[model samples]
Target: MTKTLPLRSYQFFLSIIFLLFSAPLLAQDEGEEEKPKLTLGGALRFNYNLSSWKDGQKDRGGDFGYDMFRINAVGTYKNIFLNVEYRLYSEAFGGGFLKQGWMGYKFNEEDQIQVGLTQVPFGLQQYNSHNWFFNLTYYVGLEDDHDMGIKYIHDSERIQYQLAFFKNAEELQFGSTSEIDPSRYSYDIAGRNKEINQFNGKFIYKLGKDRNHQLGTSVQYGGIYNLDTKETGDHHGFAFHYEYLGEKWNVKAQGMIVDHNPITPDTISDNVLQFGAYGGTYGVAADFNLYSLAVSRSIPVEIGPISNLEFYNDFGFMDKAEDDFEDSFMNVTGVLITAGKVYTYIDYAAGYNHSWLGGNYVDDFSAGNPDAKWEARFNINIGYYF
Candidate 1:
């Protein structure tokens, strides 16, 4: 069956497109436009890990391996601009894929529109956490998610807002396949159900003497199409967040609720949904509430090769809606060291019923073990960017 956006959403999207082309022309300045410019850069990263669950690896010291290499490009001409990033990883880790690619037009200094694969504009901008692993929100496709969409952003002195509509998640192929493709960067619904016709809105208000304090909220709604049944379901998420950026200290806090209702066959339980990324697919609780808090402090150091140090602790908890389902928890204590073009992250991450930490990949977030023990991993990631 053919998929389409809701009538109201379709109309709204067209209206924005109309404005994108028409409004920018009127807003152009009379002076000569700036010359076009393009910049290219990339990074190489490696990792070392020691896991409590892996006895053999722990006994043999630890495993150090290649993580990933990524290329980034940004270009601009007049009011049109483009940004793209492609990543290459080991075949065991999702091979290679486009992380993000988008072309945008500036209506003015304070307003702009982006088209193609772009960020959903939910939660905090750029990132909600200071660590490499991020918060629990990242696991469930709520953080740093990109999709095929159009987004409008307004940046002002005291307030900022964004609205976006995503037609679907990134597609690796044109037609339906027997199995979900897991070779991608961002997590999304990838089993029998697919994400489509999603809408997101976010607003932020800045306060404090130096405008160092920011409070924001985000909301998302979308369709979940079950390929087997040829039926479309729905999902929605809501979040409220706050951030404080001090001279050398930073704090971030957020609370969110997510619900996924997919129209699957009767044999499959609706209490869980399947999500995939990084060359694997796993189950996630269909309905849950998550809370996250992170704090960080930066210190200028005079070490031979280290110029600065950032210490941080990030904590997140997920409470499932089903009474019998066990909760999930994660905490990461780490320090980031910066020296020239090289950066290193040293982290001790622990989790209970968490996917990457210690829990079973298939059922940890769905029908989690009530008696599961906490799992921990000591990891160090080093990357050089140019």
Candidate 2:
């Protein structure tokens, strides 16, 4: 089973070449060349781990693992585009097996009308679910894409909106009264793959004449009506990114505010268990023409004593605590403490992460408020785009 994202240097180079060559093809008759009708593309990705534990022990499978490979083909015709992806999950998914053949459809470039299973485009990093680079990766709060459903998108050149309605994507859509729907979902929730119909909306607004600054927000509302009970909730997220471009200097900052009713997704039934979390995510990047480095930080609100609901059970821990932060729980104060938790945890481990290369990180903390914590992640992807 492979679980890495492939690098596409050749395909990327070809894409550049094709973009330039397309000029002549487009000049022939506008639509006479048939736009090539088909495109060939694929990537080879690998990952090796060098961490003791982020969640737990990775040695459970092995110390180092390169377990993902993706091969895909994309086609476009007029305003319709089709993308099909093949995947090979590691032994973690199904004992070193092969699971590919996911298809998608996009209409008007903004709205995607897809079938089969695909990635759930919700957050900035979550879209990179297929891990080919195994290091410190980010996993957003969103469902996996391989479920079955038909989603509609509302996006254009700058502003974008995504509204999808679907059931589980892995299994067949169940009748409104199907008992298996809830039972299957109880274990992995994939059973309802798009089986649980939903409505999701995502929008982005770009500002500044040069289009260097933008604001985006994502909101979702829907209820899961399983065989036994009807569970429903709402999720809202607000994000903004601003950047100043200069010949030899570049400054930028971006952040998001996430608030979800009934914080946990599994059991939206606990009315008192309603949750609210907010954090500031920002970063900076500087360069001298050819060389550049950009670092950004994202700290989400995971403050809650109530561990999130996963599938049909509580399979996780809450990291926000005061006396014995060891046991994860909800932040009693329900306030934002971006760095306190990290600092305390670091102190507990007797380790420190210093600021280097113009990279300075500070956690939002309050004096003596031990439970005040934030999940701030600062990352720098210093690589050439081309």
Candidate 3:
């Protein structure tokens, strides 16, 4: 199915764009601040990968490539705010993708509303990872998840919550190619076509005297459609998260259960899971669980200009709904070095019963074959934020 922005999304974007450029002119009052507060920021990332398969397969072996580049702009006038982010280039999605651009107002400290393309507050905020690849949940549409919608957020000392409604979640604009499939990360569910409206809510609590510990819960509901059979389905999920950020060490974990039910039994594809939830496997109407855990700590040791050094380990697991599809998991041990606005990650990743990408089960990793059950990759990712 071709992805296109809905009328509402287009309006929201254009309206913000207009106001951002014309706000100064519209401020006719001489005493009032004629120029809005503007902030410009972005990041550039590059990645090099050396991957080795279990059977010594040479196809898609290794490469050094451009990860992505993004530019961010924020303009604020009193309680009104505008935020825009654009992906200038990427190898996977090709030329670019619109990450997010939203406008909002802060009625007060406790209440605010935003409309446009923004994150879907589900699961862990950005997945439990300090690496470039993040976790399997990201490939399955559970992390870095954004959509066009409106959200109401309430924040206080002890409680912070969000209520949101989104349409066309993770809409892809440039499309995909054979070598790089952008759809794998796209937020389109299987057997889902029309509308794909989603409603989500998240609540978090700060505990402990320092308020360094946070616990959160999330819920999501959406209507699905089958582009081929014209059938409808239902999607629902719930997640729980916990994190503790301390001076020396930080740890976070999140788990979620999702149920996908289709009205027509034969309306979905059994070969390709909808929205690339799983690689080459199918889960039309099923329930699955996703889990992620990460822990990291800073060391006093420094190297060259790198003043802050951290060692981390991240583990993620996915339990498919059907037993025929074996579960997949990944373990990544890495070091993160930070110097100013530049961060470098050197990581070694291992996958079991799955490819390094963690989309589908690997048949090569059969029950009896010891050598076939695992694959590994060594990667270096460097990014500079400005």
Report, for every candidate in turn, its global Cα lDDT versus the true structure: 0.90, 0.32, 0.69
For every model shown, what is its TM-score relative to the native structure?
0.95, 0.45, 0.79
lDDT per residue, candidate 2, 1-386, as tens digits? 11111246335434544443354445355545455377655443333333322335334432344444555667765544566655444544332211223334433345555544544444332321111111111112232333444445566667766555444434433466543321111112221111244345566676677654545554544333333334443334443433434333333333434333322345533221111011111111100001111222223445563222111000111122223222211111111123321111110110112111111222211011243333322211111110
The runs of at least 3 residues in candidate 2 whose Cα sits more than 4 Å from the true structure, single-residue gaps closed, are: 1-36, 53-62, 95-121, 125-140, 143-147, 172-195, 225-386
The window of 10 residues in a row where model 2 has the poorest summed lDDT is: 283-292
- Model 3: pairs clashing at backbone N, Cα or C within 3 Å: 191-225, 192-225, 279-359
Q: How do the candidates rank by TM-score, highest first?
A: 1, 3, 2
Q: Give the higher-TM-score candidate: 1 or 2.
A: 1
**Comparison by TM-score, 2 against 3, better one:** 3
Which scores higher on lDDT, 1 or 2? 1
- Compose the digit string of candidate 1's lDDT tens values, residues 28-64: 7878678889999999999999999998999999899
For each of the candidates, give the backbone clash count: 0, 37, 3
TM-score, cand. 3 vs. native = 0.79
In model 2, the Cα lDDT at residue 37 comes to 75
